[model samples]
Target chain A: MLEKNKNLLDIKKLKVSFFTEEGEIRAVNNVNFSIPNGKIMAVVGESGCGKSVTAYSILRLIQKPGKIMDGEIIFHPADDKPLDILKLGEKSDELYKIRGGKISMIFQEPMTALSPVHTIGNQICEAILIHQDVTKIEARKNAADMLAKVGIPNAKNRLDHYPFEMSGGMRQRVVIAMAMVCHPQLLIADEPTTALDVTIQAQILKLMKDLQKDLNMSILLITHNLGVVAQVADEVAVMYLGRIVERSDVRTIMKNPRHPYTIGLLKSLPSLSMEKTELPSIKGSVPSLTDIPNGCPFHPRCPYYKPKVCDAGNPPDLNAVDDNHDVACFRTSQIQNEIAGKERCRL
Target chain B: MNENIKNITSTPLLQVKGLCKYFPVFSKGFFKKQIGVVKASDNINFNLVTGETLGLVGESGSGKTTTGRAILRAITPTAGEVILNYKNELIDLTKISHKKLKQLRPFMQMIFQDPFSSLNPRMTVQDIIAEPLVIHKMAKGSVLEDRVIQIMKKVGLKPEHKSRYPHAFSGGQRQRIGIARALIMNPALIVCDEAVSALDVSVQAQVINLLSDLQQEFGLTYIFIAHDLSVVKHICDRVAVMYAGKIVELAKTNEIFENPLHPYTKALLSAIPSPDPDKPMNMNISGEVADPGNLPPGCAFAPRCEFCVQQCEQQIPKLKHLADDRYVACHRSWNVEDSP
Candidate 1:
């Protein structure tokens, strides 16, 4: 059922854990998914759900005490046969060949990503020089060209501007320029616009969407905000406590969410439409990564909890209801029935 | 419109007029010379009746938080009249003494954004909640302990967890503790400064519900200062949009959302990323927020605004009332279209 042959990047049983002094923090459990070529896949969850950890693991960016225990990251290049990224050495040329050169990443804050002292032009050129075979003058020209492509005005003049000299939106554009200068196939954006105002966030999102189309690159967007997910994502992976509870197209996930956690997340958002008066909050908070609940991690706080069924059994396998939609829930059929009834009533 | 103006000013719970707070920036040398002033809260005006929520909406450096702090007397205002309707008397807080302000503090309280840093890590949850009461000399000894537990229970915090430090609790729980402390004093007015902004979606809902519940039970008024328009639209009865240390728009939540007058408000309303995936994301305001220290000769938002004309660049718009309780500060307020 797992179509590795047709996918761009297929991850199977990817487990990432951090060993704290107190105990082992199982940040990511056996996670599985595939990013289709040129598709925007969003893995969304609250803090400590291991969404960021999963993103970081793709490039082996896991810091000290954190280990990617076991997983087969089958990456299918445009010309070559599928190869497992997990098998590559830490400092291997193969790993270096893919990281930044093929799959680049952008962070939430642009200031931290770019050095304050370095000029914007120098920073972009430096990245281009390392990845591409180019002369000093050619790299500078390419950097200015990149700035213009990202919608920055007067690209040549902006080359000498420091990080602090530009606005937040401009700084983010520069960061995007730096990330996309190499023209990577897949861009992993982790809360890229979280720190920005909604206005600037719109511009940034627009930039990324435009760039994706122009470059034909897939995007893995990691965020806690469902609103952002709704805006840009083609497919959504709802993660809860280090596990994918649901994965489907953005429309299906928003319209017919079968997982209780996904339902609660949708319900939790205060509507701009002013449809709902009181937000039906999911009970209890996310458990500490070190002391996660047994069985389904979301069962304890889930509203439609079944005493022994949800709490006792191991997390259910991804049960397919539609063509591509999948939900990991023991009572998936029950939720489907309830949702159908609600829709009928509304109709 | 005149009728609304009369009712709003007749007996407001808290009335602020032309409130201004400017922080001096000094040019450093052996001798420090005053260079310029950071116009934090400039000529701000608003009024809130009892048991009503007034949301102060803005981005960073918009002076929403500064306005809240100045109202609470946390920071002294440069100039303005902050009149409070305490015990059927109009008391000017700006003119009150520090000693008098201390006594009147129990009537008003402010909850900060970051609960982790706001609550003392050294003190237990019980002590954190009890400190306000002890200082006011309202309850002491066993009575203080009982009151803290009572308030904690009201906010869904378990009495058993009272002895635990803030570090032991989660972000949501710490926020609950913060809420408990704010509600313990039974204050008439509470300024929730981005209260639920630091929380997760599911957890943010819990805190928002808790706040709504508390306001209902106690008939409390809140000056909800936040960057999230969705939250403000959900919880607030009325909202005030701030731009560069000034009140740009003020109206009922529905009015502001459905038919915003000011270009800034329209832009802000449109900027919100709707949770419904089908909703179009079109509003994209470029250009940085105008520096408060060295503002332009005209409207602060004129630079970024799409519909700004030559008049906007040369004239500073004054806050003026429009149709029935709606107020907007823009030279071309009538010309600006509403959010789609």
Candidate 2:
């Protein structure tokens, strides 16, 4: 059963499709996940794996030709009422109220995220004034405070600077400050640190984690870095071909991955603990959306693929391996054995 | 330690010393002319031994990519010598003729950072992989096609998929095509510039493994340039940490990770996000990297270094051997305790 403790965001069997010239591309295929109140859940995968599409589905920001074909995106309001974000009609007043006030999203590219013409201060204050009933002067001060809260040095001076005048790290902080200015209950950050250097990335991740604790708001961090998930996420959902292949607590997933794809991913990562020998790579690439194989989409790359069960038919529904851990692989038991065998050989 | 030192002395395939590449900065005014130079690489020194992977890790504008490009002669260097050991003869790459340079290019190939833009989108995968072979005049006619198919299979690509264009493949598959092109030459030294940084973690592992296996098969030396410390730690035999067009620290992979000496190197390692969420973030350094064009008089990192003393700002530090093979360019490396 889904947790009923006033979950912040609950997505149920959400299906998203893109009506391309070739055909309908199922970007998100029956994906289900939930963010408990005041927790971080990371949706992780490589490019074209539909992690970003799922985040866009939450804010109804999917572009033309892309539609949420099926399922519900339920958001529990701060006032304790559940609203289906997918049901909100276009350009409705209710949609506008939740767009920037209750649910906020930060995009990957900061240059595009912030308008080039407007100063950062004006942008943050605009978000404040759009939602809250406040004067321009008061909104400006609130925006500056939010900037200061995100660790932007000399926030007052930076308020008058445009996006081009600031560095990449500073521009990203301004975006984060703007997203959190309204005290949104749910924040979605999509590959927020992908464009930043490692040092700046560490700083931003620390800032986000600190803010999450202070604000007690739920965050859905979408990134391809498993190391990042291990650092910031309490729970993680490993996505492949727009579906959740594995979901578990961060520690469990890192220590003992069940799905073959997840296991291959862990082995492929070049860790400091690994020796200078050849790295273990998954043999094949992710199938393109146009040529997604029948049955299991990951069967080709699955190391534990049993032809009759894995290739010919869909794996059983996500089976509970433990409390709060679920995997969609039919050969979870065999895969675990193989992983353990590999570890023994490694030792 | 002596084994690695012996390894370095045994036979260096490529030896680079005091390599400097400066781009003149021009301004438009009453007497507008070349007033200064952007020191992309300043008196950089390193040697690539045979069958060794030297990882060059640095932030953007640190000159890691420039160092790799200059070694390959992709861009002409302003000064310094590149002594390449070709068949037991040390030939200066800077002094080579145009035709000779073309002949030598097959021995040293470069794998670019972005696979999407690096590969020719207009060409089919077969043509993309076979370009290097054709350019080097290594194969022709049906022989070239067979070689291309063989290289594709070696890199985990299906031979039947060779007719498809780059747009039909994913990021991982496109990278494979890039690898096939780089490997088709059977070069002695391959410079992988941010090769895996553009990939997903899962796909990055596969590429890293493929690179390692290929290195063993061909006995190739790699100048692996990337900003990711973890990946560098896993693959590199030795690492050279660069800061503002200079090698600040050079040591074995474990030595550099465990005992990073330069202030810049220390800051870089601390900034790497540890996988453990329970452990608090250890990075305390602040402010963005200083502009490379207008670096400080002494150490470029002194402006943001936490342990900056009066001496640090007044005089530049020189690279000194701290151990048998470890080198550091910091005044405080001797006395500073482990901060990470």
Judged by TM-score, which candidate is best?
A: 1
Query: In model 1, what lDDT does residue B235 have?
Result: 93
In the range B1-340, model 1's lDDT, one tens digit per residue, is 2244345556899999999999999998977899989999999998888888899999889999999999998999999999999989889999999999998999999888998899999999999999899889999988888898889899999999999999999999999999999889989999999999999999999999999889888989899999999999889988999999999999988998888888888888888888788897868577777779889999999999888899999999999988778999999887665423
- lDDT score, residue A344, model 2? 100
Please report how far candidate 2 places residue B282 from its true position, in Å.
2.1
The superposed Cα distance between candidate 1 and the true structure at residue A109, in angstroms, equals 1.9
User: For all the candidates, what are their Cα RMSDs to the real structure?
Assistant: 2.8, 2.8
TM-score of each: 0.96, 0.94
Runs of candidate 1 exceeding 4 Å displacement: A1-6, A341-347, B1-9, B337-340
Residue A334 in candidate 2, Cα distance off native in Å: 5.0
Model 2 regions lying over 4 Å from their true place = A1-5, A333-347, B1-10, B28-32, B136-138, B276-280, B338-340
- Chain A accuracy of model 1 expressed as TM-score: 0.95
Interface RMSD of each: 1.4, 1.7
lDDT score, residue B61, model 1? 90
Q: Residue A14: error of model 1 in Å? A: 0.3
